[model samples]
Target: MKSMTSRAMRAIVTVSLGAISTAAFAQADYPTRPIKLIVPFTAGGGVDTVARIVGEELKGVLGQSIVVENLPGASGMRGAETAVRAEPDGYTLLLSSAGEAAVNPHLFKNIKYDPSRDLAPISLVVKVPNVLVVNAASGMNSLDDLIAFTKSNADKASFSSSGVGNPQHLAGELLNRMASVKLTHVPYRGAAQQVTDVLGNNVTATFASYLAVASFVEAGQVKALAVTSSERIPSLPSVPAMAEHPQLKGYDVTNWFGLFAPAGTPGPVVDKLNKAVVQVLSNPVTAKKLADLGSYPSPKQPEEFKSFLATESEKFKNIITTADIKAQ
Candidate 1:
């Protein structure tokens, strides 16, 4: 009986070793087929566009076609859910914005997958800055003017954002917290409308995407008060950074995008993906294209990106908790 038990244990060890060898070999030759890149937003949207740009470059680097699939919905949760549940093979990946990867799970209740646990970070892809703009006709010329206006007219003051619990919304909330002013929050389904309402003076101001407000700002239709970054962006050199304010030096919120694979993916596979992403982002043409969209490439290795995500998650959670902000 002892001999039989010993033989059984040997057999089990042999089988486990065989499986390990097979998986390692597979990971070594990762992407034997086309890789699917999921974008949790509709085609032509910012996320999708960024995914395609990176995907196109990845095709050349990996020597395999990168297929982009849009699975937008549930506030960008659908694609995240699908990606998280996918096989831990390198074939499936997600190019996610800050909302899905860091904010949405906290903003919305009962997310099926925890981003920090269920996704393997590849690299940070891009960072986008929002320009807080008010209608040029509002007679509000600077951040100080806007703060004073909102403080004195709290009952009538309002600000618009792309949606609740996003960077734009939280930026406004951060301003309220540090400045001790109460600006009524107004959510918009579309950014264009956010600008439209601001232009119409239907809302006092908006934390608008640079793309949405660029032409308007150049056209002098909306006043670009300050950008939501630690320093001014090159595209809008004259505009000040939110943190430049003496009392609001801590103000900094940016919408970013990153690449991720399903959790439990092999380390070899993850490393290869991160390398490809970094290479793609470093190309001059790719940088120019992203720059044209008002975004800039900012690449980080898996561990670095993971750390950044953690910091961002905590910041979002603290704001949401303090403001009692929720999505219905």
Candidate 2:
């Protein structure tokens, strides 16, 4: 019996050593092939664009090709679920926005993965502020005018968002709740479509990323009312923030994009990815490009990003619960 027990312990030790050796070898030869950065939205949107730009820089930094794969559906859940289930070898990553990484868990009834536990945050890439814009034909020029109009025509006025349970949608809901108004919601397939519908006057207003509607606003196709940031954006200084409005006492909503790997990724691999991202975001040329698109680099440490995500999750959970937003 003692001999059998000794043999069993020896077998276990050999297996453990083999596993450790395999993991170390895998980590050492990490990125033996191309890495996939899964963008949870379709191509030609802000998230896709950001992924391409950052992927280019990452390639140069990491000496490995970064392939961006667009898998759009279920308001980004399909792609997120894919990444969450991927192996934790640092090769597969999710390039997701605040809606997917922070907001969706709170709104959806049966999310297959939890961002807080199923994934590891590598770094925060950019912070994009959404603006409230109206079609030029609407004649709603300033924040005051729009507020008054919505207040008077609460039942008639409607606002469009990228989708239900999106950050933009939640922003509009926050405004409606705070201002004591009943502005109707119109959900679109994506930000591009939302911008189109707003510019076509199909909806009274839209909460959209500035990148999606900046050209339209500049071309006089749409009128910018207020940004959803705490301060005015440099590119659109004339537009006030919702927080500045007396009716919106503490309104603040901004969209963020970050890189994340599957949970259980080794610390060394996570650090490697985070360092590469920080270098890419810290470059002046990359920063300029992101800023040109109305986004700013937010290169946070991995742990810091993890903590921020936790807080944001709690915040959106409360907002969703209070607003009684149901998933579609």
For each candidate, C-alpha RMSD in Å?
Answer: 1.5, 2.4
Best by TM-score: 1
lDDT of 2 by residue, 1-328 (tens): 9999999999999999999999888777676788999999889888899999999999998889999999998889999999999989898999999989899888877889989889999999998899999999887788777778988986778899978888888898888888877679899876788888876777889998888888998899999989998788877888898899888867788888999999999988998899999999999999899988988898999999999889878877777887899988
Model 1 residue 128 lDDT?
Answer: 91
List, residue by residue over 131-240, the lDDT tens digit for candidate 1. 99999998998999999999889998999998988889999999899889998889998899999999888999999778889999989899999999888987899999
Among residues 3 or more apart in sequence or in different chains, the pairs in candidate 2 whose N, CA or C atoms overlap within 3 Å are: none
Candidate 1 Cα misplacement greater than 4 A, ranges: 1-14
Alpha-carbon shift of residue 198 in model 2 (angstroms): 3.5
- For all candidates in order, the CA lDDT equals 0.91, 0.89
